[model samples]
Target: MKIKVLGCSAGIGDSRRTSCCLLDADILLDVGTGAGELSLEGLIGINHVFLTHAHLDHAGLLPLVADAAGRFRDRPVIVHALAETVAALRECMFNWRLWPDYAALPSLERPFLRYEAVEVGATLSLGGRKITPLPARHAVPAVGYWIDSGQASLALSGDTTLCEEFWDALSRIENLKYLLIETAFLNADAALAAVAGHMTADLLAAGLSRLRRPVEVYVTHLEPGWEDRIMAEIGAACAGFDVRRLRQGMEFEF
Candidate 1:
């Protein structure tokens, strides 16, 4: 499986972009402003989107992408998320006032977007990948994804705090090669990170100690301007793992 980091910043400013990832060619993990950087061809090829939560930084471009791709692709974009996350999206984002409900646009029966309310611990097959949604700690309904493509498995800690269930799910995946975890704040903002359900460098180190298997860890979702500080903190705290910051446009084949 090829994973592309379309955007990895916790928030947007300067050169930083919010969370968004492209899995292979057809699947999108989030639709943040980073998605706007994709080529038109990239936009049209996305057949599925698995959102972690309903935060604007994570799902800002969903409706626009569905609408833009509607003209080129005949099929609707399948948006998979937890039930409450879907509800939040409907009530906040897809409401007729904010954007056209593409879930019912073009036609009620055949729309450009569809929502699949995925439950925690449930695994679903999408194309060649098996996706398992895991419970996450956040201000709103959230979930992390465990993706296995028959070769290597990966755990994505969608914006979350140090949660036991998240670690438990990670421990269950065999041959887990990569962990795209989030570190949204610096150590100085530990309190803020906790309240916002985000991980700081120190918090992430504590979480890593619970893992039994060795994995290449790529830290993402950093608040802009503190990337250097957060990266240094992660390196200082965890020396046993190959930990690095995620960069936009970086593509990895695993």
Candidate 2:
């Protein structure tokens, strides 16, 4: 399986975009602003979207994606997320006030979008790939995804702070090769990071220290303007691990 980083920044700016990843071509890990980078044809080809949470930086482009691709597709795009996240989208995002309710758009029987509630520990299989929702502690109900392509696996710590259950889940993935974790702030903003349910460099290192196995760590979601400083702090704190900053357009095949 191939994983492509469409966007990995915490916030958008000149060349930076928010979280969004394309797993191969048919599945999206999170449909944030980076989704806008896709061509119209590429957007129309996406059959499934796995959302981490209801936050704008993680799920902002979903409505627009539905609106842009709905007319060209024969079937609705399947959206997989937590029950609370789904509820939040329905109540806040697709309420018709903020955006049209794509789940009911076009027609009820033949709509533009579909919702599937996923719980922590539940795994969904698509073709030969397995996507499992992992534990996450965020400002809202959230989850990370464990993408297993049989030969290897990757764990994404979607917008979360310190959570023992997340490490417990990661420990069980014996073939895990890549860890795309988020460190959204520098040490200077540690207090804000805590309040926002995001990790600072120090917090990330402390969490990584719990892992029993070594994996290629990629730090994602670095807030704009602080990327360099945050990465330097991560390097200093997580000295033993092979960690690097994730960049847009980066691809991994496993």
Candidate 3:
């Protein structure tokens, strides 16, 4: 399996793209602004989207992608997300007022998009890979994903704070190679990080201290302007682990 970092910034700015990842070539981790970087052919080839939450940065491009793809093909793009997140998308994003309802476009039976409500802790298989939705702590309903493809597995923390279940679930998986966790703020923003259900350098370090096994940890979703400071702080805090900051266009093959 190959995981490509489309964007890993906390907010959009020059040289910063929102959080999004591509699994192999068919699956998307989140359809954030980074998705806009994909070519028209790449966009049409995407078959499934596993959304982390309903936040605009995490799911902002759904409507546009669906609309563009719908016009070029007859296939439906499956959006797999938590029920609440799915509901929120319909109510806030895909509503006719905000954007045309792709779920009802073309025809009800042959719509351009399909929403699949995934349950936390459940694993679904597709295209020879297993996608497990792990519960995540966020302002909105969210989940981390453990994607297993025969010989290798990768875990993504999505956007979350310290949580026992996330660690416990990861421990149960064998041969886990990489952990794509979030570090949305610097240590100075610890208070804001906590209230926003995001992790800071200090908190992420303390949280990872409990892990029983070590994995290659690549932190993502950092505030663009503080990337260097945040990376240095996280490095100091997680000195014992193989931790690094995720950069756009970086690729991981497992």
Q: Of the candidates numbered 1 and 2, which has the greater lDDT value?
A: 2
- How do the residues 1-254 of candidate 2 rate in per-residue lDDT, one tens digit apiece? 99999999999889998999999888999999999999999999999999999999999999999888999999999999999999999999999999988899899998999999999998999998999999998889989999999999999999999888998889889999999999998898888887899998889888888888889999999989988899999999998889998999999999
- TM-score for every candidate vs. truth? 0.97, 0.99, 0.97
| TM-score of structure candidate 1 | 0.97
* Whole-model alpha-carbon lDDT for candidate 2: 0.93
Regions more than 4 Å wrong, model 1 = none
Q: Per model, state how many residue pairs clash.
A: 0, 0, 0
What C-alpha lDDT values do all the predictions have? 0.88, 0.93, 0.87
For residue 214, model 1's alpha carbon misses the true position, in angstroms, by: 0.2
What clash count does candidate 1 reach?
A: 0
Error of 2 at 210 (Å): 0.3
Off by over 4 Å in 2: none
Query: Per-residue lDDT tens digits of candidate 1, residues 1-254?
Result: 88898888888888887888899988999888888887888999999999999999889989878877887888889999988989999998888999988888888878899999999999999777899998789877899998898899888888998888898778888869999999988898888888999998788888889887888899999888888988998888887778988889988777
Itemize residue pairs with steric clashes in candidate 1: none
Instruction: Candidate 3: list runs displaced more than 4 Å.
Output: none
Q: Whole-model lDDT, candidate 3?
A: 0.87
